[model samples]
Target: MKALIVYASVHHQNTEKVAKVMAEELGADLVPIGQAQPSTLTAYDLIGFGSGVYGKKFHKTLIQFVEALPAVTGKRAFIFSTSGGGEIQTHAAPKKLLMNRGFSIVGDFSCKGWTTWGPLKLFGGTNKGRPNEEDLEEARVFARGLKEKYI
Candidate 1:
Protein backbone atom coordinates (compact mmCIF):
# COMPACT_ATOMS: atom_id res chain seq x y z
CA MET A 1 0.00 0.00 0.00
CA LYS A 2 1.11 3.53 -0.65
CA ALA A 3 2.32 5.37 2.44
CA LEU A 4 3.64 8.77 3.36
CA ILE A 5 5.84 9.53 6.37
CA VAL A 6 5.55 13.14 7.36
CA TYR A 7 7.86 14.24 10.13
CA ALA A 8 9.53 17.09 11.96
CA SER A 9 12.91 16.28 13.41
CA VAL A 10 14.75 19.04 15.11
CA HIS A 11 17.43 19.14 17.83
CA HIS A 12 19.60 16.21 16.63
CA GLN A 13 17.65 15.00 13.62
CA ASN A 14 16.85 11.79 15.47
CA THR A 15 13.29 11.39 14.27
CA GLU A 16 14.29 12.32 10.74
CA LYS A 17 16.72 9.41 10.73
CA VAL A 18 13.96 6.99 11.65
CA ALA A 19 11.59 8.44 9.10
CA LYS A 20 14.11 7.92 6.30
CA VAL A 21 14.58 4.27 7.13
CA MET A 22 10.84 3.75 7.26
CA ALA A 23 10.45 5.54 3.95
CA GLU A 24 13.10 3.38 2.31
CA GLU A 25 11.62 0.19 3.66
CA LEU A 26 8.04 1.05 2.82
CA GLY A 27 8.83 2.75 -0.49
CA ALA A 28 6.84 5.67 0.81
CA ASP A 29 6.93 9.38 0.30
CA LEU A 30 8.95 11.37 2.83
CA VAL A 31 8.20 14.99 3.56
CA PRO A 32 8.54 17.43 6.38
CA ILE A 33 5.30 18.32 8.15
CA GLY A 34 5.85 21.88 7.04
CA GLN A 35 5.74 20.75 3.44
CA ALA A 36 2.71 18.54 3.84
CA GLN A 37 -0.71 19.70 2.78
CA PRO A 38 -3.80 18.25 4.41
CA SER A 39 -5.52 18.07 1.05
CA THR A 40 -2.98 15.62 -0.36
CA LEU A 41 -3.30 12.97 2.34
CA THR A 42 -5.83 10.89 0.44
CA ALA A 43 -3.27 9.83 -2.16
CA TYR A 44 -1.71 7.38 0.25
CA ASP A 45 -3.37 4.31 1.67
CA LEU A 46 -1.19 4.55 4.75
CA ILE A 47 0.15 7.61 6.52
CA GLY A 48 2.93 7.80 9.08
CA PHE A 49 3.28 10.76 11.42
CA GLY A 50 6.53 11.14 13.30
CA SER A 51 8.35 13.69 15.37
CA GLY A 52 10.82 14.22 18.15
CA VAL A 53 8.84 14.33 21.37
CA TYR A 54 8.65 17.75 22.95
CA GLY A 55 7.21 17.89 26.45
CA LYS A 56 5.43 14.55 26.00
CA LYS A 57 3.87 15.21 22.61
CA PHE A 58 4.54 15.03 18.93
CA HIS A 59 5.65 18.28 17.35
CA LYS A 60 3.03 21.00 17.44
CA THR A 61 3.13 21.55 13.71
CA LEU A 62 2.22 17.95 13.01
CA ILE A 63 -0.62 17.98 15.50
CA GLN A 64 -1.90 21.16 13.93
CA PHE A 65 -1.60 19.68 10.48
CA VAL A 66 -3.60 16.63 11.41
CA GLU A 67 -6.18 18.83 13.09
CA ALA A 68 -6.50 20.86 9.92
CA LEU A 69 -7.01 17.82 7.73
CA PRO A 70 -10.49 17.30 6.34
CA ALA A 71 -12.41 14.40 7.81
CA VAL A 72 -10.35 11.36 6.79
CA THR A 73 -12.58 8.56 8.00
CA GLY A 74 -11.15 5.07 8.25
CA LYS A 75 -7.69 5.88 6.85
CA ARG A 76 -4.86 3.63 7.87
CA ALA A 77 -2.01 5.22 9.84
CA PHE A 78 0.94 4.70 12.15
CA ILE A 79 2.83 6.85 14.65
CA PHE A 80 6.49 7.14 15.56
CA SER A 81 8.54 9.36 17.78
CA THR A 82 12.03 9.95 19.10
CA SER A 83 12.61 11.07 22.63
CA GLY A 84 15.07 10.99 25.46
CA GLY A 85 12.57 8.93 27.38
CA GLY A 86 11.29 6.96 24.39
CA GLU A 87 8.02 6.42 26.15
CA ILE A 88 5.05 4.99 24.25
CA GLN A 89 2.79 7.54 25.90
CA THR A 90 4.52 10.29 23.98
CA HIS A 91 2.51 9.08 21.01
CA ALA A 92 -0.77 9.60 22.82
CA ALA A 93 -1.76 13.07 21.74
CA PRO A 94 -1.28 12.51 18.06
CA LYS A 95 -2.79 9.05 18.23
CA LYS A 96 -5.90 10.45 19.87
CA LEU A 97 -6.16 13.19 17.29
CA LEU A 98 -5.90 10.74 14.40
CA MET A 99 -8.45 8.40 15.93
CA ASN A 100 -10.87 11.26 16.38
CA ARG A 101 -10.49 11.88 12.67
CA GLY A 102 -11.44 8.19 12.17
CA PHE A 103 -7.98 6.96 11.19
CA SER A 104 -7.21 3.42 12.15
CA ILE A 105 -4.25 3.08 14.49
CA VAL A 106 -2.42 0.16 12.99
CA GLY A 107 0.88 0.49 14.90
CA ASP A 108 3.29 2.76 16.70
CA PHE A 109 7.02 2.93 17.31
CA SER A 110 9.34 4.80 19.62
CA CYS A 111 13.08 4.92 20.24
CA LYS A 112 15.43 6.86 22.45
CA GLY A 113 17.20 9.74 20.80
CA TRP A 114 20.12 11.90 21.78
CA THR A 115 18.52 14.81 23.54
CA THR A 116 20.43 17.70 25.04
CA TRP A 117 17.85 20.37 24.99
CA GLY A 118 16.90 22.44 28.08
CA PRO A 119 18.10 20.98 31.36
CA LEU A 120 19.19 17.73 29.78
CA LYS A 121 21.92 19.59 27.98
CA LEU A 122 23.61 20.05 31.36
CA PHE A 123 24.19 16.29 31.46
CA GLY A 124 25.54 16.21 27.90
CA GLY A 125 22.58 14.23 26.60
CA THR A 126 20.49 11.13 26.90
CA ASN A 127 20.63 8.19 24.50
CA LYS A 128 23.79 9.53 22.97
CA GLY A 129 24.57 8.10 19.51
CA ARG A 130 21.07 6.71 19.33
CA PRO A 131 18.85 5.94 16.38
CA ASN A 132 22.06 4.14 15.64
CA GLU A 133 22.49 1.23 13.25
CA GLU A 134 20.53 -1.14 15.45
CA ASP A 135 17.73 1.34 15.96
CA LEU A 136 17.44 2.04 12.25
CA GLU A 137 17.39 -1.66 11.50
CA GLU A 138 14.63 -2.09 14.02
CA ALA A 139 12.76 0.69 12.28
CA ARG A 140 13.34 -0.97 8.93
CA VAL A 141 12.01 -4.20 10.34
CA PHE A 142 9.08 -2.38 11.85
CA ALA A 143 8.22 -0.82 8.51
CA ARG A 144 8.41 -4.17 6.78
CA GLY A 145 6.12 -5.66 9.39
CA LEU A 146 3.63 -2.84 8.98
CA LYS A 147 3.62 -3.51 5.27
CA GLU A 148 2.90 -7.16 5.90
CA LYS A 149 0.08 -6.40 8.30
CA TYR A 150 -1.64 -3.57 6.44
CA ILE A 151 -0.77 -3.96 2.80
Candidate 2:
Protein backbone atom coordinates (compact mmCIF):
# COMPACT_ATOMS: atom_id res chain seq x y z
CA MET A 1 0.00 0.00 0.00
CA LYS A 2 1.07 3.53 -0.63
CA ALA A 3 1.77 5.33 2.62
CA LEU A 4 3.17 8.57 3.97
CA ILE A 5 4.09 9.96 7.35
CA VAL A 6 3.87 13.71 7.94
CA TYR A 7 5.33 14.72 11.26
CA ALA A 8 6.78 17.51 13.40
CA SER A 9 9.75 16.94 15.67
CA VAL A 10 11.20 20.26 16.66
CA HIS A 11 12.68 19.76 20.10
CA HIS A 12 14.70 16.55 20.10
CA GLN A 13 13.81 14.76 16.91
CA ASN A 14 12.30 12.00 19.01
CA THR A 15 9.10 11.60 17.11
CA GLU A 16 11.10 11.75 13.91
CA LYS A 17 13.05 8.71 15.01
CA VAL A 18 9.94 6.66 15.63
CA ALA A 19 8.36 7.87 12.39
CA LYS A 20 11.40 6.79 10.46
CA VAL A 21 11.27 3.23 11.79
CA MET A 22 7.57 2.91 11.08
CA ALA A 23 8.04 4.33 7.64
CA GLU A 24 10.83 1.91 6.85
CA GLU A 25 8.73 -1.02 7.99
CA LEU A 26 5.84 0.12 5.87
CA GLY A 27 7.94 1.49 3.05
CA ALA A 28 6.20 4.83 3.48
CA ASP A 29 7.44 8.26 2.59
CA LEU A 30 8.39 10.69 5.32
CA VAL A 31 7.47 14.34 4.98
CA PRO A 32 8.07 16.95 7.60
CA ILE A 33 5.05 19.06 8.42
CA GLY A 34 6.55 22.16 6.85
CA GLN A 35 6.88 20.33 3.54
CA ALA A 36 3.58 18.46 3.45
CA GLN A 37 0.83 19.48 1.07
CA PRO A 38 -2.74 18.82 2.17
CA SER A 39 -3.85 18.57 -1.44
CA THR A 40 -1.54 15.66 -2.11
CA LEU A 41 -2.53 13.43 0.81
CA THR A 42 -5.18 11.54 -1.08
CA ALA A 43 -2.57 9.70 -3.08
CA TYR A 44 -1.67 7.46 -0.19
CA ASP A 45 -3.59 4.45 1.06
CA LEU A 46 -2.36 5.18 4.54
CA ILE A 47 -1.20 8.40 6.19
CA GLY A 48 0.40 8.93 9.57
CA PHE A 49 0.32 12.08 11.63
CA GLY A 50 2.71 12.45 14.52
CA SER A 51 4.63 14.91 16.65
CA GLY A 52 6.26 15.41 19.96
CA VAL A 53 3.75 16.16 22.69
CA TYR A 54 3.71 19.83 23.51
CA GLY A 55 1.45 21.17 26.24
CA LYS A 56 -0.52 17.91 26.02
CA LYS A 57 -1.15 18.23 22.29
CA PHE A 58 0.52 17.88 18.94
CA HIS A 59 2.74 20.56 17.51
CA LYS A 60 0.70 23.50 16.17
CA THR A 61 1.85 23.03 12.60
CA LEU A 62 0.82 19.38 12.46
CA ILE A 63 -2.57 20.21 13.89
CA GLN A 64 -3.01 22.99 11.39
CA PHE A 65 -2.14 20.67 8.52
CA VAL A 66 -4.99 18.37 9.45
CA GLU A 67 -7.29 21.32 9.96
CA ALA A 68 -6.54 22.70 6.52
CA LEU A 69 -7.39 19.42 4.85
CA PRO A 70 -10.76 19.04 3.20
CA ALA A 71 -12.98 16.36 4.63
CA VAL A 72 -12.86 12.98 2.99
CA THR A 73 -14.37 9.54 3.35
CA GLY A 74 -12.47 6.25 3.67
CA LYS A 75 -9.04 7.73 4.11
CA ARG A 76 -6.98 5.64 6.51
CA ALA A 77 -5.05 7.39 9.26
CA PHE A 78 -2.95 6.57 12.25
CA ILE A 79 -1.62 8.78 15.06
CA PHE A 80 1.67 8.64 16.91
CA SER A 81 3.56 10.78 19.36
CA THR A 82 6.52 11.00 21.68
CA SER A 83 6.70 12.72 25.04
CA GLY A 84 8.40 12.52 28.40
CA GLY A 85 5.41 10.60 29.75
CA GLY A 86 3.89 9.05 26.63
CA GLU A 87 0.40 9.69 27.93
CA ILE A 88 -2.60 8.39 26.00
CA GLN A 89 -4.34 11.75 26.09
CA THR A 90 -1.79 13.20 23.72
CA HIS A 91 -3.44 11.35 20.85
CA ALA A 92 -7.00 12.33 21.75
CA ALA A 93 -7.26 15.68 20.02
CA PRO A 94 -5.52 14.61 16.86
CA LYS A 95 -7.63 11.47 16.65
CA LYS A 96 -10.76 13.55 16.92
CA LEU A 97 -9.55 15.88 14.22
CA LEU A 98 -8.84 13.03 11.85
CA MET A 99 -12.18 11.38 12.52
CA ASN A 100 -13.99 14.65 11.95
CA ARG A 101 -12.28 14.86 8.60
CA GLY A 102 -13.81 11.43 7.81
CA PHE A 103 -10.59 9.45 7.88
CA SER A 104 -10.98 5.93 9.17
CA ILE A 105 -8.91 5.58 12.30
CA VAL A 106 -6.59 2.61 12.12
CA GLY A 107 -4.29 2.52 15.14
CA ASP A 108 -1.93 4.64 17.21
CA PHE A 109 1.46 4.49 18.89
CA SER A 110 3.32 6.47 21.55
CA CYS A 111 6.56 6.22 23.46
CA LYS A 112 8.69 8.18 25.85
CA GLY A 113 11.27 10.52 24.38
CA TRP A 114 13.99 12.63 25.94
CA THR A 115 12.36 15.72 27.35
CA THR A 116 13.85 18.68 29.12
CA TRP A 117 11.14 21.20 28.46
CA GLY A 118 10.39 23.86 31.06
CA PRO A 119 11.88 23.20 34.50
CA LEU A 120 12.98 19.73 33.59
CA LYS A 121 15.94 21.35 31.93
CA LEU A 122 17.07 22.49 35.36
CA PHE A 123 17.33 18.84 36.43
CA GLY A 124 19.07 17.60 33.31
CA GLY A 125 16.25 15.82 31.43
CA THR A 126 13.70 13.04 31.47
CA ASN A 127 13.67 9.84 29.45
CA LYS A 128 17.10 10.66 28.17
CA GLY A 129 18.23 8.39 25.31
CA ARG A 130 14.64 7.34 24.86
CA PRO A 131 12.69 6.40 21.79
CA ASN A 132 15.57 4.07 22.31
CA GLU A 133 16.08 0.79 20.53
CA GLU A 134 13.27 -1.02 22.32
CA ASP A 135 10.77 1.72 21.58
CA LEU A 136 11.78 1.71 17.94
CA GLU A 137 11.40 -2.06 17.75
CA GLU A 138 7.88 -1.70 19.09
CA ALA A 139 7.16 0.86 16.43
CA ARG A 140 8.35 -1.55 13.79
CA VAL A 141 6.05 -4.15 15.25
CA PHE A 142 3.17 -1.71 15.21
CA ALA A 143 3.79 -0.88 11.57
CA ARG A 144 3.93 -4.53 10.72
CA GLY A 145 0.55 -5.03 12.32
CA LEU A 146 -0.93 -2.17 10.32
CA LYS A 147 0.50 -3.59 7.14
CA GLU A 148 -0.64 -7.11 7.92
CA LYS A 149 -4.11 -5.94 8.82
CA TYR A 150 -4.75 -3.10 6.42
CA ILE A 151 -2.21 -3.11 3.66
Candidate 3:
Protein backbone atom coordinates (compact mmCIF):
# COMPACT_ATOMS: atom_id res chain seq x y z
CA MET A 1 0.00 0.00 0.00
CA LYS A 2 1.16 3.49 -0.73
CA ALA A 3 1.59 5.58 2.38
CA LEU A 4 2.99 8.97 3.32
CA ILE A 5 4.45 9.91 6.69
CA VAL A 6 4.61 13.68 7.10
CA TYR A 7 6.14 15.35 10.12
CA ALA A 8 7.46 18.62 11.60
CA SER A 9 10.26 18.87 14.10
CA VAL A 10 12.25 21.63 15.74
CA HIS A 11 15.20 21.41 18.15
CA HIS A 12 15.82 17.69 18.54
CA GLN A 13 14.93 15.52 15.57
CA ASN A 14 13.02 12.94 17.57
CA THR A 15 9.79 13.22 15.60
CA GLU A 16 11.59 12.70 12.32
CA LYS A 17 13.31 9.63 13.71
CA VAL A 18 9.97 8.09 14.52
CA ALA A 19 8.60 9.01 11.12
CA LYS A 20 11.54 7.42 9.36
CA VAL A 21 11.12 4.18 11.26
CA MET A 22 7.44 4.11 10.44
CA ALA A 23 8.13 4.87 6.80
CA GLU A 24 10.72 2.12 6.56
CA GLU A 25 8.43 -0.35 8.28
CA LEU A 26 5.48 0.38 6.02
CA GLY A 27 7.61 0.96 2.96
CA ALA A 28 5.93 4.34 2.84
CA ASP A 29 7.26 7.61 1.52
CA LEU A 30 8.53 10.18 3.96
CA VAL A 31 7.64 13.82 3.50
CA PRO A 32 9.05 16.51 5.72
CA ILE A 33 6.21 18.93 6.26
CA GLY A 34 8.52 21.92 6.16
CA GLN A 35 9.53 21.09 2.58
CA ALA A 36 6.14 19.83 1.40
CA GLN A 37 3.81 21.99 -0.63
CA PRO A 38 0.05 22.03 -0.19
CA SER A 39 -0.60 19.95 -3.29
CA THR A 40 1.84 17.18 -2.46
CA LEU A 41 -0.54 14.95 -0.54
CA THR A 42 -2.73 13.26 -3.10
CA ALA A 43 -0.78 10.16 -4.02
CA TYR A 44 -1.23 7.90 -1.05
CA ASP A 45 -3.59 5.29 0.29
CA LEU A 46 -2.67 6.11 3.89
CA ILE A 47 -1.24 9.32 5.29
CA GLY A 48 0.34 9.61 8.72
CA PHE A 49 0.80 12.98 10.33
CA GLY A 50 3.24 13.53 13.17
CA SER A 51 4.82 16.47 14.96
CA GLY A 52 6.61 17.57 18.05
CA VAL A 53 4.39 19.13 20.68
CA TYR A 54 5.00 22.82 20.90
CA GLY A 55 3.21 24.67 23.70
CA LYS A 56 0.59 21.95 23.96
CA LYS A 57 -0.27 21.96 20.23
CA PHE A 58 1.22 20.58 17.07
CA HIS A 59 3.75 22.55 15.07
CA LYS A 60 2.23 25.26 12.86
CA THR A 61 3.44 23.49 9.74
CA LEU A 62 1.41 20.41 10.54
CA ILE A 63 -1.70 22.45 11.23
CA GLN A 64 -1.27 24.14 7.89
CA PHE A 65 -0.81 20.81 6.13
CA VAL A 66 -4.06 19.49 7.51
CA GLU A 67 -5.81 22.71 6.57
CA ALA A 68 -4.58 22.47 3.03
CA LEU A 69 -5.15 18.79 2.40
CA PRO A 70 -7.56 18.11 -0.43
CA ALA A 71 -10.67 16.03 0.11
CA VAL A 72 -9.41 12.86 1.78
CA THR A 73 -12.73 11.22 2.41
CA GLY A 74 -12.53 7.48 2.90
CA LYS A 75 -8.74 7.63 2.98
CA ARG A 76 -6.91 5.87 5.80
CA ALA A 77 -4.74 7.87 8.16
CA PHE A 78 -3.10 7.89 11.57
CA ILE A 79 -1.50 10.36 13.96
CA PHE A 80 1.67 10.20 16.04
CA SER A 81 3.35 12.64 18.39
CA THR A 82 6.64 13.12 20.25
CA SER A 83 6.70 15.33 23.28
CA GLY A 84 8.53 15.96 26.51
CA GLY A 85 5.28 15.70 28.34
CA GLY A 86 2.68 12.99 27.96
CA GLU A 87 -0.37 15.03 27.19
CA ILE A 88 -2.63 13.34 24.67
CA GLN A 89 -4.03 16.64 23.36
CA THR A 90 -0.89 17.12 21.30
CA HIS A 91 -1.96 14.14 19.24
CA ALA A 92 -5.66 14.91 19.51
CA ALA A 93 -5.46 18.31 17.83
CA PRO A 94 -4.03 16.92 14.59
CA LYS A 95 -6.22 13.85 14.70
CA LYS A 96 -9.29 16.04 15.00
CA LEU A 97 -8.19 18.22 12.15
CA LEU A 98 -7.65 15.26 9.81
CA MET A 99 -10.87 13.65 10.92
CA ASN A 100 -12.75 16.82 10.05
CA ARG A 101 -11.25 16.59 6.62
CA GLY A 102 -12.85 13.13 6.29
CA PHE A 103 -9.83 10.91 6.78
CA SER A 104 -10.22 7.72 8.74
CA ILE A 105 -7.82 7.58 11.71
CA VAL A 106 -6.76 4.00 12.20
CA GLY A 107 -4.33 4.41 15.12
CA ASP A 108 -2.22 6.85 17.10
CA PHE A 109 1.16 6.77 18.86
CA SER A 110 2.96 9.01 21.32
CA CYS A 111 6.22 8.93 23.26
CA LYS A 112 8.43 11.24 25.26
CA GLY A 113 11.38 12.78 23.50
CA TRP A 114 14.46 14.56 24.74
CA THR A 115 13.89 18.12 25.84
CA THR A 116 16.72 20.60 25.72
CA TRP A 117 14.59 23.59 26.50
CA GLY A 118 13.86 25.29 29.79
CA PRO A 119 14.74 23.72 33.13
CA LEU A 120 14.86 20.24 31.68
CA LYS A 121 18.12 20.99 29.96
CA LEU A 122 19.61 22.39 33.15
CA PHE A 123 18.29 19.50 35.16
CA GLY A 124 19.82 17.13 32.66
CA GLY A 125 16.97 14.72 33.11
CA THR A 126 14.52 14.50 30.32
CA ASN A 127 13.55 11.94 27.75
CA LYS A 128 16.78 12.29 25.82
CA GLY A 129 17.91 9.83 23.15
CA ARG A 130 14.36 8.92 22.79
CA PRO A 131 11.75 8.02 20.59
CA ASN A 132 14.45 5.52 21.56
CA GLU A 133 14.61 1.83 20.98
CA GLU A 134 11.36 1.15 22.84
CA ASP A 135 9.56 3.92 21.05
CA LEU A 136 10.70 2.73 17.65
CA GLU A 137 9.61 -0.76 18.49
CA GLU A 138 6.25 0.59 19.48
CA ALA A 139 6.05 2.49 16.22
CA ARG A 140 6.89 -0.64 14.27
CA VAL A 141 4.16 -2.52 16.10
CA PHE A 142 1.76 0.28 15.40
CA ALA A 143 2.60 0.21 11.72
CA ARG A 144 2.18 -3.53 11.62
CA GLY A 145 -1.24 -3.16 13.17
CA LEU A 146 -2.19 -0.56 10.61
CA LYS A 147 -1.13 -2.87 7.83
CA GLU A 148 -3.13 -5.68 9.34
CA LYS A 149 -6.24 -3.67 10.04
CA TYR A 150 -6.42 -1.57 6.92
CA ILE A 151 -4.24 -2.91 4.15
Candidate 4:
Protein backbone atom coordinates (compact mmCIF):
# COMPACT_ATOMS: atom_id res chain seq x y z
CA MET A 1 0.00 0.00 0.00
CA LYS A 2 1.19 3.45 -0.84
CA ALA A 3 1.48 5.84 2.11
CA LEU A 4 2.51 9.43 2.61
CA ILE A 5 4.10 10.46 5.89
CA VAL A 6 3.92 14.20 6.37
CA TYR A 7 5.62 15.60 9.42
CA ALA A 8 6.97 18.74 11.12
CA SER A 9 9.68 18.72 13.74
CA VAL A 10 11.57 21.27 15.77
CA HIS A 11 14.18 20.95 18.49
CA HIS A 12 15.33 17.29 18.50
CA GLN A 13 13.68 15.94 15.33
CA ASN A 14 12.36 13.08 17.41
CA THR A 15 9.05 12.95 15.57
CA GLU A 16 10.82 12.72 12.22
CA LYS A 17 12.81 9.76 13.48
CA VAL A 18 9.60 7.94 14.30
CA ALA A 19 8.10 8.92 10.95
CA LYS A 20 11.08 7.51 9.10
CA VAL A 21 10.85 4.20 10.90
CA MET A 22 7.14 4.02 10.11
CA ALA A 23 7.78 4.87 6.47
CA GLU A 24 10.53 2.26 6.13
CA GLU A 25 8.32 -0.40 7.62
CA LEU A 26 5.45 0.47 5.29
CA GLY A 27 7.64 1.12 2.25
CA ALA A 28 6.11 4.56 2.08
CA ASP A 29 7.33 7.93 0.91
CA LEU A 30 8.45 10.58 3.34
CA VAL A 31 7.28 14.13 2.77
CA PRO A 32 8.18 17.00 5.02
CA ILE A 33 5.07 19.15 5.42
CA GLY A 34 7.00 22.37 4.96
CA GLN A 35 8.11 21.43 1.44
CA ALA A 36 4.80 19.94 0.43
CA GLN A 37 1.90 21.97 -0.80
CA PRO A 38 -1.53 20.93 0.24
CA SER A 39 -2.51 18.03 -2.04
CA THR A 40 -5.27 15.62 -2.79
CA LEU A 41 -5.35 12.45 -0.74
CA THR A 42 -6.58 10.31 -3.62
CA ALA A 43 -3.07 9.36 -4.73
CA TYR A 44 -2.34 7.42 -1.57
CA ASP A 45 -4.08 4.45 -0.04
CA LEU A 46 -2.79 5.21 3.42
CA ILE A 47 -1.74 8.48 5.04
CA GLY A 48 0.35 9.02 8.13
CA PHE A 49 0.33 12.51 9.64
CA GLY A 50 2.68 13.41 12.44
CA SER A 51 4.37 16.24 14.30
CA GLY A 52 6.04 17.12 17.57
CA VAL A 53 3.68 18.18 20.28
CA TYR A 54 3.97 21.81 21.24
CA GLY A 55 1.95 23.25 24.05
CA LYS A 56 -0.66 20.47 24.07
CA LYS A 57 -1.10 20.68 20.31
CA PHE A 58 0.63 19.64 17.12
CA HIS A 59 2.99 21.89 15.26
CA LYS A 60 1.08 24.69 13.51
CA THR A 61 2.16 23.58 10.04
CA LEU A 62 0.77 20.11 10.52
CA ILE A 63 -2.53 21.52 11.73
CA GLN A 64 -2.82 23.65 8.61
CA PHE A 65 -1.88 20.77 6.34
CA VAL A 66 -4.53 18.54 7.82
CA GLU A 67 -7.07 21.31 7.62
CA ALA A 68 -6.34 21.79 3.93
CA LEU A 69 -6.18 18.14 2.82
CA PRO A 70 -8.83 17.01 0.37
CA ALA A 71 -11.59 14.95 1.81
CA VAL A 72 -10.14 11.49 2.58
CA THR A 73 -13.55 9.78 2.84
CA GLY A 74 -12.74 6.07 2.81
CA LYS A 75 -8.97 6.33 2.77
CA ARG A 76 -7.06 4.93 5.73
CA ALA A 77 -5.12 7.40 7.87
CA PHE A 78 -3.27 7.47 11.14
CA ILE A 79 -1.88 10.12 13.49
CA PHE A 80 1.31 9.92 15.52
CA SER A 81 3.14 12.34 17.74
CA THR A 82 6.00 12.89 20.17
CA SER A 83 5.82 14.87 23.37
CA GLY A 84 7.61 15.34 26.69
CA GLY A 85 4.45 14.90 28.69
CA GLY A 86 1.78 12.19 28.72
CA GLU A 87 -1.22 14.44 28.23
CA ILE A 88 -3.64 12.83 25.74
CA GLN A 89 -4.70 16.12 24.13
CA THR A 90 -1.27 16.52 22.63
CA HIS A 91 -2.18 13.61 20.36
CA ALA A 92 -5.95 13.70 20.64
CA ALA A 93 -6.48 17.19 19.24
CA PRO A 94 -4.83 16.41 15.92
CA LYS A 95 -6.51 13.01 15.61
CA LYS A 96 -9.84 14.69 16.27
CA LEU A 97 -9.12 17.31 13.66
CA LEU A 98 -8.34 14.70 11.02
CA MET A 99 -11.28 12.51 11.92
CA ASN A 100 -13.52 15.52 11.64
CA ARG A 101 -12.22 15.94 8.11
CA GLY A 102 -13.61 12.52 7.12
CA PHE A 103 -10.39 10.53 7.27
CA SER A 104 -10.59 7.08 8.77
CA ILE A 105 -8.42 6.92 11.84
CA VAL A 106 -6.54 3.61 11.79
CA GLY A 107 -4.00 3.96 14.57
CA ASP A 108 -2.15 6.49 16.70
CA PHE A 109 1.34 6.46 18.23
CA SER A 110 3.04 8.71 20.77
CA CYS A 111 6.06 8.77 23.05
CA LYS A 112 7.89 11.13 25.35
CA GLY A 113 10.86 13.10 24.13
CA TRP A 114 13.28 15.48 25.83
CA THR A 115 11.71 18.85 26.42
CA THR A 116 13.70 21.64 24.88
CA TRP A 117 12.23 24.44 26.99
CA GLY A 118 10.64 25.11 30.39
CA PRO A 119 11.23 23.41 33.72
CA LEU A 120 10.98 19.87 32.38
CA LYS A 121 14.57 20.10 31.23
CA LEU A 122 15.76 21.98 34.31
CA PHE A 123 15.94 18.93 36.57
CA GLY A 124 18.27 16.57 34.75
CA GLY A 125 16.16 15.52 31.71
CA THR A 126 12.94 13.73 31.00
CA ASN A 127 12.97 11.16 28.23
CA LYS A 128 16.49 12.00 27.17
CA GLY A 129 17.81 10.00 24.18
CA ARG A 130 14.23 9.20 23.29
CA PRO A 131 12.11 8.52 20.76
CA ASN A 132 15.07 6.30 21.37
CA GLU A 133 15.66 2.76 20.19
CA GLU A 134 12.64 1.32 21.94
CA ASP A 135 10.35 4.05 20.61
CA LEU A 136 11.44 3.47 17.03
CA GLU A 137 10.93 -0.27 17.42
CA GLU A 138 7.46 0.37 18.75
CA ALA A 139 6.77 2.63 15.79
CA ARG A 140 7.90 -0.10 13.39
CA VAL A 141 5.58 -2.62 14.97
CA PHE A 142 2.73 -0.12 14.90
CA ALA A 143 3.36 0.58 11.24
CA ARG A 144 3.24 -3.13 10.49
CA GLY A 145 -0.08 -3.39 12.21
CA LEU A 146 -1.45 -0.44 10.27
CA LYS A 147 -0.34 -1.99 6.98
CA GLU A 148 -1.77 -5.39 7.81
CA LYS A 149 -5.10 -4.09 9.04
CA TYR A 150 -5.74 -1.16 6.76
CA ILE A 151 -3.52 -1.43 3.75
lDDT of 3 by residue, 27-132 (tens): 8889898788756677778888889998888899889878987766568989998898855677777778788888988888888888887876877758868878
User: How far off is residue 17 in model 4, in Å?
Assistant: 0.6
Q: Which segments of model 3 are wrong by more than 4 Å?
A: none
Worst 10 residues of 4 by lDDT: 85-94
Q: Arrange candidates by lDDT, highest first: which order?
A: 2, 1, 3, 4
Per-residue accuracy of model 2 over 1-151 as CA lDDT, tens digit each: 7899999999999999999999999999999999999987978879999999988889999999999999997789999999989876889898999999899989999999999898879888899899999999999999999989877
The residue ranges of model 1 lying beyond 4 angstroms of the native Cα positions read none
What is candidate 1's local distance difference test score?
A: 0.89
How do all models score by TM-score?
Answer: 0.95, 0.97, 0.93, 0.90
Q: Better model by TM-score, 2 or 3?
A: 2
- lDDT, candidate 4, residue 71? 60
Residue 82 lDDT, candidate 3, scale 0-100: 88
Worst 10 residues of 2 by lDDT: 84-93
The model with the greatest lDDT is: 2
Point to the candidate with the largest TM-score. 2
User: For candidate 4, lDDT tens digit of each residue in 37-143?
Assistant: 76645678898988888877889998988888766567778888888874446767777788887877888888877775677667766778888898889899999
Candidate number that wins on TM-score, 1 or 4: 1
lDDT scores for all predictions?
0.89, 0.93, 0.84, 0.82
Cα lDDT over the full model 3: 0.84
Q: How far is 106's C-alpha from truth in model 1 (Å)?
A: 0.3
